[model samples]
Target chain A: MLVIEGLLKRYPDGFEALKGVDVTIEDGELVALIGPSGAGKSTLIRCVNRLVEPTEGTIELNELELTTLNRAGLRRARRRMAMIFQNYALVERLTVMENVLSGRLGSVGFFKSLFRRFPQDDVDNAFALLEKVGLEGLHDRRADALSGGQQQRVGIARALMQDPDILLVDEPTASLDPRTARQVMGLLADLCEEHGLAAIINIHDVPLARDYTDRILGLKAGELVFDGPPEELTDDVLPEIYGGEDWSKEPSEDDEEEEDIRSSGQFLAEEVL
Target chain B: MPVEQREDTVVWRRRDKRQAVIHWFVTLGIAAVVLWCFKLIADDTTWEFVWSAPEQGADLAIRMFLPEWFVDIPQLWRDGELWVHVAEYFRQRGLYAMELWDPLVDTIHIATLGTVLGVMIASPLAFLAARNTTPSTTFVRPIALALLVTSRSVNSLIWALLLVVIIGPGMLAGIIAIALRSVGFCGKLLYEAIEEIDENTRDAVKSTGASGMQVLTFGVIPQIAPAFAGISIYRWDINIREATILGLVGAGGIGMALQSAIDTLAWGQVSVIFLAILATVVLSEWVSAKARAAVT
Candidate 1:
């Protein structure tokens, strides 16, 4: 289980990104963190990994307190959690195999990794994870050579190569096409099921999150306004989380398609302006 | 601030009236100062030499056009016996005299060795200077910057002048001079490259529980590899040109040949040295360009 108590992140400029938030997540839970832009969804996920240091909080992963860990202790603690990025942040020049193997850097010695001499077991696990993530024969290709969907798959393979207990995914589908986004989300959900791993996914697409995740945590301006099963995240609650946005319309299949076209058209109009 | 509402119309200007007046006065002041300096220079000038300069330059060019392919330098060979045969053999093929070959090779060595040494010293200093990579900004960065600035402020020719006196005038002096100058050029460009690296990619690697060294190896190095390569090769190309002139200060290269030829009033041999230096510079440019293209 992962537990966060009074998690606070106030930047140097005194902007509070996470305001004394408290939450708990159990194993095998696929929790979707949904909010509009600047709503602290990304901040909360990064804070759990201590990528963005919290101003004040206790982040306990499995029984160990993460916030209090020193440099070496933090590295050790971080090994239990792997993060996925929206940009699929692979070292673009490195081969997919090398990028995947980099996930094992925490356990490997510096010289060993420096010479590309990863342990044989880690190499084998890397190959297995690559195959598991549906990148069976593309390991030798450079990360930049892959398409958006393919690169995200590589990112997933890299994260799984760490053998972590939980995944902190930041806007994983933000840059992807709708179909690829859904596929990636489905894959994450499936992998969570297969490995019995907990995942905290920061997602902007409400329908996609509801479709793939078991629970939804809604945040608004650094505050967790709603936390419940996806079924409980009704239209009425969305306005409270998103703040005054029109949520009365039915989000049916056809309506979602219309919304996609409308949004894209709005983007095109803005670009022209 | 420059926008104004005049009756029913709105007007926009790049500058307000006061600013435009100031800009006009600044331009007038600059032009007046330039004319005054030119008049001072004209008043102090030797007009006779200025008028005869074209005639003197043409006469020199005619002499330089007929380059001497063979020369007897008593400093070379075993008391002139070996020199005659070698000069005759090379002159038949229209190649440079044997005296120029050793110094040409020495110039190449100076450039190559200097660039390698510079890269060695600059790599660590670059890491210290880069904002994202430095261990301590307040303590270490200023020291690294100071070292880079010291290396940069003095030209390689001046460095060679000092080194020739201390190290006693050899290829060693030329190499150190080039290396010292290169450290600043390479370090400044490399650190800027490091600072501009994709922070997201680095953060992702750090998020994987990678250690500091691992983050650099996997995250940072790959991002900056192309920039590092291009900078090093570009510096090497410049160092080749710089090395050719290092011998002017007694640091050992083609410039020594040119200096000696000028001292003996051998204009033909001086022209040959100029041609040789030009060809070497062009070749280095081509190689560096190809190498930089391949990496990027």
Candidate 2:
């Protein structure tokens, strides 16, 4: 479980990206945090992991108090929570297998990481995770050579190798096309079920988030204005999230869950086209 | 956008009336301050006196040692006897004959060894010095800065001179000086390279709760390794040139040979050494360019 209380972040330049935000997520829940640009969706998610330090608050993940933990302690806490970035953030110079193996670095001793002498289990697990993401054959390929969608897939496999209890994704689909976005989100949804992991993702695609996630958390200007199941996410709630009407065609209750997205096949066509 | 709004006319010409009359006033003020200070220290007799600054600093050094045969030397041109020694150096064969190649080889050897050692030492030091990579900037930063400044400020020649006196003249003096100097050059440069790397990679690792050491190994090292290699290689080439000069103080290598020939006034041998040095420098330059390109 992840819990936040009276969380606030104010930049030294005086921009309040998060204002007294309070939220909690249960174990194995797939929570979609949806908001438009500069709405602090990413900031809120980052704060949970102590990436952007909360100026004042308590972020409790299991026994770890994120705000109170020193760098080393926070790093130990991080081993339990993996993060997927929008840009993938795979070290471009390293091969896919190396990138995946890096996920175990927090647990592996420092000398082992330097020498890249990850334990046999770690090596096997990395290869297995790569296979799970359907990047089995490209394990040794340079990360920069992969397509954006494929790179994000590699990012997911890397995160899973951490054996994290919770996963936070910040705009995982932002750089991807619509079809690819759907595919990645579907993968996340599948992983949540397969591993029984809790996931919080910051997303801009309202319709896609509605289709993929079990619950939705909406934010606008550093405040959580709406929290409910995906079925309750509607056109009315979007204006509250984005500060204006956008893609205003309301999805009927029957149409809230996308039937068009069946598998990677249909999603690839939308992505490529 | 219209050209008129974007472009402005150049102003070049200035009238005598528009000239800043305060220029002479500033110059006069500076001159007056200098003269005032001078007046406070010395009188007109000293000013009028012909100030013959002595060349005794380097020339008079070590004159009282050994034999009367090595005593007070006349200027080469003034004595008109320099050609005799030049002829003798060229004519002397076997052990007495100065071989430019020997010193050249030594200088190159010392430089290569020093550069390699320094780079090995500085690579991890740079990572420790980077504010983002290290656990604390408070300790490593000042220490790194101090190391860099001290290495750079104390010229390699000075290092060689001191070491030569302590360790006795040989290649070791040259090598130690080059290594010490290159540490400053490479550490300072490599640390900056580490600092300039994109924070995005580190951010993900941090988000995963990577330890400081873990982040450095996975997040920072891969990003900066290539550039670090390039910087260290560049410093190696620079140290090679410095190694040659270090021998002027009796360190070792081709410079020692060159200094001996110069001392003996062997223009023929000196010219031969110069040509060899020129070739080596050009070849090393090309090699350095290739090495740098490979890394970057």
Candidate 3:
């Protein structure tokens, strides 16, 4: 469980990226944060991990106060809340195994991690996670050698290596094609269900979010405008979330094509389950 | 179309006369300064000596390349004594080769040790100078930059000369001088490499709850390793060449033999030492290139 209240992020230059916002996520729930660019979706997820420090809020993770922890305590807390980046930010020069093993950095001591002397169990678990993420035999390859989808798979495996309770993913499929994006979202949904991990995914595609995630949180200009089950996110509320777009227009040919692809993706996701 | 054409023509005709005058003035000023420099050189130098330099060089080349004690062609045909002089020359070269072996070895060792020492000192200083990695920009960055500037401002020869005064002249002075000169070179390149590392990768490493040092190890070091290896190998190649000359300032290397030969007018030994230095440099260049290829 994660609880955030009145979270605010004011940049040093006086730009308020996130205004007062509140959110609570339960265990085993997959929530999609949907908004246009600069809607503070990324900032909200980053705040949960303290990657972006909250200016005026309290964050509680499984009843532990995360906002006021010291540096060491914060690091330990961070180990339980793994993050997946949109760009799959693996060290390009490091091998996949090394990048995955780095997820155990907070658990191991400095010297041990520095020398790359991960425990036997950690190594075993890393290999298992790699297999689980469908990268069964590419552990020795360099991170940059993998394709975009493969790299994101490695990113997911690396995050899971932390044995995290709640995964914070920031735009996981933005860089991938539509087909690969649906596949990645299906994989994440499957992983969440199997592991009972709470995940907050910040995403851009509204149809994918509605079709896949359990719930949706909508933001517009740093404020949470809507929060409900995906079925309740009607067209009327999208205007509130995306700031007064012409929602009454007739569906164009492109929209119909997109709708077909999205419905098929939903069907595929359901079939996988 | 006529109005637009007329307007375009007017605009084209209206050149910036002031700018053109400034450009002409700048060009003329540069030319004047260059001509003044040439006039100063011509006034100070002896033109007769400059004109005679080619003839003087030819005369010295003839004296250096030819020996009056050489056997006549008719005498060689009569007695086969030409092989005797050639064998004597080879024997003398062999003895010089034996004498040069230790100094050549010392030069290589000095370069290796100096490069290692420079890398050791430069790595931490580079972290301090890197904008992203520095602990404190106001304090640490400035100090690191100043140290790098100080190291770079002095040439290795000058550093060797200074060290010889303090250390009383040995391989130690040569090694220290090379190391000091290399610190700035390595640090500047390493810091640039550090600054150019992918910010997203660094943030990803930090997100793993890794401490600062862990982030540096897992994130920063991997990205910089290839650049570091290439820079170190190149510096070692250059240091080998520099080490050959350190002995001129009483720092131990083949330059000591070259200096002694020059002082005593032993041109043959000087030529031999030059050949040895050339061979060492070529070998180092080859090794450096291979190492760089492997690393990158």
Best by TM-score: 3
A-chain TM-score, model 2? 0.90
lDDT tens digits by residue: candidate 2, A140-212: 8999999999999999998998999999998899899767888889999999899999999987666677888
**Which predicted model would earn the best DockQ?**
1
Reproduced native contacts, each prediction:
0.81, 0.70, 0.75
Assess each prediction's global lDDT (C-alpha) against the native: 0.88, 0.79, 0.88
**What's model 2's overall lDDT?**
0.79
lDDT by residue for model 1 (A1-273), tens: 999999999999999998999999999899999886888988998998888998998999999999989999999988999999999999999999999998898898999999989999999998898888899889899999999999999999889888999999998988987778878999999999999999999987777777889999989889999999989987777778776555554333455654653343222222222
- TM-score ranking from best to worst? 3, 1, 2
lDDT of predicted model 1: 0.88
Which has the better DockQ: candidate 1, or candidate 2?
1
lDDT by residue for model 2 (B1-296), tens? 11222257644434333244566677889999999988877764554333433444333332321222233336654688666655554465323434566777787899899999888877777777777776577886778777777887888899999999999999988899888888888888888998998788888766666677777777888898898888877887888778878878999987887788789865445556666778778778899999888876
The number of clashing residue pairs in each candidate reads: 0, 7, 0
* All DockQ scores: 0.81, 0.53, 0.70
Model 2 complex DockQ against the native: 0.53
**Cα RMSDs, all models:** 5.8, 8.9, 4.4
